[model samples]
Target: MADITAAMVKDLREKSGAGMMDCKKALNETAGDMDAAMDWLRTKGLAAAAKKSSRTAAEGLVGVAVSGTKGAAVEVNSETDFVAKNDQFQQFVRDVTQVALDGAGDVDAIKAATLPNGKTAEDTLTTNVATIGENQSIRRVKRLEVSQGAVVAYVHNQQSAGLGKIGVLVALESAASNDALQALGKQLAMHIAAAFPMALNEEDLDADLIERERAIAAEKAGESGKPADIVAKMVDGAIAKYRKEHALVSQLFVMDGKTKISDVVAKAGKDAGAEIKLVDYVRFQLGEGIEKEASDFAAEVAAASGVPQQPAPVN
Candidate 1:
């Protein structure tokens, strides 16, 4: 067996983006063969899934596709909105969205899945980057399915027919007629796109996020100079309100702005004569969590406002 050296371990770590120990183990598993070790790391998902040219955060399109009880949403990001509006880029997003709907399930899986052009999705993206002279990557993908109901899709700030800044998929499970389910799902999807609930339910909310909110609430309540017990009660109340306001079912429907989403679904169920459950949803807002480079931001500002490079948008 070939001996693994620190230089080999460091090199593998840089190449695979895996932990030092993992890289060393991969090298050992492949008998210190770098190419084989890289493949080993990828097979274990320790390497980057996409062959990205750069890590700079940039603009892109969110694409949504639907078929009966299943729907898929994907975000394909590029170096600029100009590239996002490219015909080739849009077609690539559409193709990847369809691949996700066909059960690609996640970004890694979709990147490995074959496109109609007989190339893997990642290869197609690499080719697009080279041909279009802009770096791009398949940022993310989400798929939703319902057992006996409909999954509805909505695109906000559309760049094309199915490509947009925000893509939402709502899954409604029921035995009601498909027509009724479709109508309800569309309305709910619109509401989801607008309200931006953090989770499907109070129980589904992230614990860390909840704790962060609680900390902020406590600090604000402490400023009221109340007794310890009163302050504790106030914090609890604040947390309860936060949970309600940030959960999909508990949020007031955007249309009426008074009735809770849970109530809206129940009323719709009554109208359709079946029990309906809002099961799950996926919302992809373009470039939401990406870390943007200042240079990229300046260029985006220039492109968007038709002015020379300026500071990024305040919001």
Candidate 2:
């Protein structure tokens, strides 16, 4: 067998438009023969599939899967909402999310994992794109595992089991019964999904963001006609308030609208006969911060109906 080089992989990818893993596999199977590699990819329908890789896929589903004390979530995106309902795409998201469960929150590891059909994650994405007639992607994935506690998962806006528009995982570290811990974990995960808090505590919050807020607060304090001591106190107060509002455990639980999540966890811990800690969490909301062009429906309607009489005014 001929030794396949990196250049061969690159060339195969360029010609077939297939993913790196798929290209390499094809090249290796063809004994580093470029023409044979191209033919192999084409026969598998992977070449045409790769051509759709460049399309913007900002809409799709978030999927979650849990196994024992670990849980994982993944975001699989498509170019349009119509494809999100495709059974195959949904199944891919769900299966990939399960694969992510074994990855220990490593996105790269999850992407490199083999799919059930003996294809890499990237190859699955390419195949999905070709069959669905739209570009698709495994946008992100995260796994949460606990040594002595349970990792609970939640999927919001679910179209099917373990697949949805929002996915969340909450890790609760405790020596309590899994049943009790999981109940609390589910509620906490829901709280996190709804609130989108920055961190679990003030110390964990983004330092740069905190510093920026403090600067703004100090500037405001300087105009208050107070002494330096008073200004310092004012800045401290502002920062404390910011921390309470932004931190996960400090923030009020959205479901209840009054109690802090930390307080709830403390109470649950007592009932469970162990000290419970919110060690970590992961939340994946589909297309978060992905800007899509907004259209004015009324304007489009008028233009289509030939009723657009308004002319641009000279500035």
Candidate 3:
């Protein structure tokens, strides 16, 4: 069995929001497996379903750029947040995003593309890491384009012009006026930032994700002690609700909290004197889905002071 360290227990506590002793016990039961420990806590009703184990340890900027009907967004992750604030790091992100505009959102292509400084983007990133004293990478790039109409960009918690923690792009296909399209796009982009929709429509959602949610709902419904038919109905209802809540068009608009996003887009199009179709959208939240290494502060201090580290006391 894997030894359960105090840091592992602490990480489980943070992920499950359970007591320290409970977290330690759960980790032991799961053989020091973090994912299994979280599941054990949830099964025992000691943790909330919304609790997530993913850590946002990587820090950097999400840079966005819009030119005419095309827009691009790039995420550059650094080992530390302090580097995110560095002018050189920020400039690298900005330039990489601009490179992505022509790279068609391909990370490899963007890396090979030329920068204004006459060096390959990948070479510049390596140079930045050496000078900035931290590891960094161009994590992701996404571009949106429309044959007609405008692609609007928005940055939430803006760190600078076109750079922020959350970057969003909304693509509208329409013959509408640019000003009207941009206004509607900005509103939709802001909604995407807040709502965190999984997909543009129900059909667009991941099949695997939907199946997993269905399995969980079915298990929960089965525990209700209802008839098999009733349990089936309950599971279906839960899945339908999940789809409505997660799909962008079916989700309620954040602005009004009552109108569906599909209806909001229809009304905006009518007001703009043209028909607008929300063709696509992208929302990039930094460090999402990345599991960072848990920091061992006690060990760090012990090493710094040249003293042996002590194990945490178990209650």
Which has the greatest lDDT?
3
- What's the TM for model 1? 0.76
lDDT at residue 220 of model 2 (Cα atoms): 67
The residue pairs in collision within model 3 are none
Q: What is the lDDT of residue 37 in candidate 2?
A: 75
- The regions of model 3 sitting more than 4 angstroms off are 1-6, 18-33, 36-55, 310-315
User: How would you encode candidate 1's per-residue C-alpha lDDT over 1-315 as one tens digit per residue?
Assistant: 899987789866765688999999989999999766766665565775322212324698999999988999998998888998799999999999999999999899999999999999999998998999998989888889988888988898888898998899999999998999889988998998888888999999999878766766676678788999999999999899988988999999999899999999999999999999999999888887575644555677678988886445666
**Predicted candidate 3 versus true structure: per-residue lDDT over 1-315, tens digit per residue:** 789987788888887789999999898899988877876776567887542512455688899999989999998998878988999999999999998886556999998999999999999999998999999999999999999998999999899999998999999999999999988999999999998898999999899878877777777788889999999999999889989998999999999899999999999899988899999998988887777776678889999999998767779
Against the true structure, candidate 3 has what lDDT?
Answer: 0.88
1 or 2: which has the higher lDDT?
1
Instruction: Please give the RMSD of candidate 2 to the true structure.
Output: 18.1
Which consecutive 10 residues in model 3 have the weakest lDDT in total? 49-58
Better of 1 and 2 by TM-score: 1
Tell me each candidate's RMSD, in Å, in order: 14.4, 18.1, 2.4
The numbered model that scores best in TM-score is 3
Per-candidate TM-score against the hidden true structure: 0.76, 0.72, 0.91
Regarding TM-score, does 1 or 3 come out ahead? 3
- Evaluated at residue 272, the lDDT of candidate 1 is 97
